[model samples]
Target: MIDTRMIGDVRVTRIHEYSGPTHDPKFLLPDLSQELLESNREWMSPHHWIPLMNKLILTVQLWVVHAGSNIIVVDTGVGNRKPREGMARMHNLNSLVLEWLEAAGAPPDKVTHVALTHLHMDHVGWNTRWLDGRWTPTFPNARYYLPQDDFLFCESGRNKQEGLDVFGASFEDSVMPIVDAGMSVMLKPGMEIGDCLQVEDARGHSPGQVAFRIRSRGEEAIFSGDICHNPIQIVHPEINSGYCIWPDQARKTRMEFLASSADRETLVLPVHFGNPYAGFVRREGAGFRFEPLLW
Candidate 1:
């Protein structure tokens, strides 16, 4: 289960997963390739890696006001039976995500929208469910938002040509189900679905990756979906992950995101971090740090 916070009139719910030690160590912010290559060491010890309070890693669910009406889920995590073997071992999808959603009072029908930050498997798994031996969009009444660039990248020869069918079925089974049902829309950056929520292109992890910014009653927060995996990356913005398609581009994107939210007033919702849904970016010694929101 996760905590729920209200920003202005919007009730922001965070569905967290205590996926300690199950995730790939490399995905940790300090283990990014750029940071690894710069340092001679292979990894950081547990002492150096632990958070200030010795906390564990926590993933988040960002629920924004749906078209200023209801709620929209951003980036559903790995769902059940997602083929988690070998390199993808860490990509396991359990029912807790959906359970947490229900616990937070959001049933499958309650979620009216699912915004895919990118076409990555981990971000899109829960977009659909396995039913009658086929994958189908989880939300019947909701529309799935896909960035045109990301859709093309995934559907193109990128994964299939290499015989890597990890996230392929998700688009076809989960996303396309909604699309065929007329519930999916290919969106461009800066598209406004409502008065409160807006999509912005923060590409680089993927060609057309985007982030959602939700503003309500003079207070605003950005659902930074996978742009930076952990808080440590905020301090070491130059780091690049192995999955990063373009290292340089990813770096630039992260920098821009940091700059945009560096101010104390802005709430940054990092999709995968230990705790605190929103945080204030602060200038530390040589780089920036994420100061988690107290409330």
Candidate 2:
């Protein structure tokens, strides 16, 4: 189920669902080659790998949103019963997130907007659900938002989605319905939905990837999609995940995000990384480190 928290007047929620070995330890390590690690001085640190193997499973967060007039879902996460690639092993379909939303006073039908950080399988799985023998948009009344560049890059057909089918059907089954229904919004940087929300250019992780900046009741928060996978990644922004389409650009984006906002009191909502949703960035050494806020 999803956990809920309120930052001033803005309500932030997250769906704790995923598709993978719940207790796998390998995800904690940077997706780097041994040779690359050996040659790079920056990647060599005690914090390079977490010692508590058992805690690794707690990482990966499926974030949800209840910002302003919209019940915005940042990433849908891996949906139930969908075939996945890599370590994604999800099952037993249930709407724990919807339950949490109801408990938080936001019902499914009341949701006005659904936003995606990227098009990875895990981020878009819950975008649709199996019903009547077909996948359909879960939010019946909401307008689905996706970056145009991200949509084109993933659906371009130039790259092989050999192991990324979990994310494929979302566009065809889930997202297309909204587009066909006229409830889809494609955004560029600086786009404003209302007085309290704005979109910022946060590319690299995915081309044209954008982060949502929310301001309300004198508080500020940025839903940082996959800018940093783990808290450790904050201090090692140079490390790249195997799935990053453009590693060099991803690395640069990570650095810029850290340098621009880590020291300030901005609340950063990263997609993954165990508990403690919001945090401030700190400069530990050559790289920046995440200081998660304790709830």
Candidate 3:
């Protein structure tokens, strides 16, 4: 079943497009020591940790938010066809992203906004689709609110200097098409798309990385982008994915984000958390922990 739950007034549904092992622990987040995994094995096993392969099981999902007649998407998971070199697992492949969206009754055209927390390959893949021998904006009517800094940064082609040009082609295919289609908007921090949704900058993973805080009748949930990819980071906030462009900035942003989420008892909706893609943040000694929302 498609995981759908009401958060105050917004209907937040998880369209789990893909799930499996993507990165080895050492490669996913090098700072995460084996000792840390062993210490937390009692809790993480079977669901999150794969000891044999040492890979953290993660999911690529898109969160669809229904607010005041607006259908907003937070991150479009890996799209169907793209030349995602080096990332063979989900590259040049077929995906059910759109079909699942349709099954949920939220077709691409009905989508009002496609707010990408950042312009990463996986997050922006479905922003466009292969059409007529060329990539084109997938959501014809949705105004995509991408971060200004990120759009410009990626546009500048500086991602090559950052060493993950693996996403270079993705920018050319998924993002640029939206801009050409005149459906892309540069997001500003504190930008409000609706009374229930507001944007906040959470840079580090990407220059323009942003998170959305949705509030309705005082109930709140945060759509935290790649600030922390897996539940393991909730326990060890210092760890950063190897894809992070600014390591120090990424770590700082993560710890602070976790602290606030824990203090506020906010529901955190992340892009790559495994099975239960949405959860709450809780303080666990000096760090924090993810309490998955089974509902």
Q: Which candidate number has the best TM-score?
A: 3
lDDT of 2 by residue, 1-295 (tens): 4566776787787656632224333443446444443443343222333233332323445555665666666767766666543443444345366566577655767777777777766577766777788776777887777777877765675334544232455566555665677777887788865344578887876676788787777677788888776565675677765556677888888888888775555778877665554577877677675676665
RMSD of each: 4.3, 4.3, 1.3
lDDT for 147 in candidate 1 is 81
Off by over 4 Å in 1: 23-68, 87-92, 160-169
Q: Ranking by TM-score, best first?
A: 3, 1, 2
lDDT of 1 by residue, 16-114 (tens): 644443344454443455444234222222312432333325454545343446668877776766655664433445557777777777778887777
Report residue 236 deviation for candidate 1 (angstroms).
1.0
Clashing pairs in 2: 19-89, 20-89, 262-281
Model 3 over residues 1-295: C-alpha lDDT tens digits? Answer: 3788888878998898788876788888778889988898876775687877778888888989888888888898788878876778778878777888888768999988988899888888899888899998888878998888888888887887877763567788899989988888899798986556688889888888999998777678899989988888888878888878888999898988888888877889998888777788888676677798877
Comparison by lDDT, 1 against 3, better one? 3
Higher lDDT: candidate 1 or 2?
Answer: 1
In model 2, the Cα lDDT at residue 133 comes to 84
Q: Could you tally the backbone clashes for each prediction?
A: 1, 3, 0
Who wins the lDDT comparison?
Answer: 3
| Between candidates 2 and 3, the lDDT winner | 3
TM-score of 3: 0.96
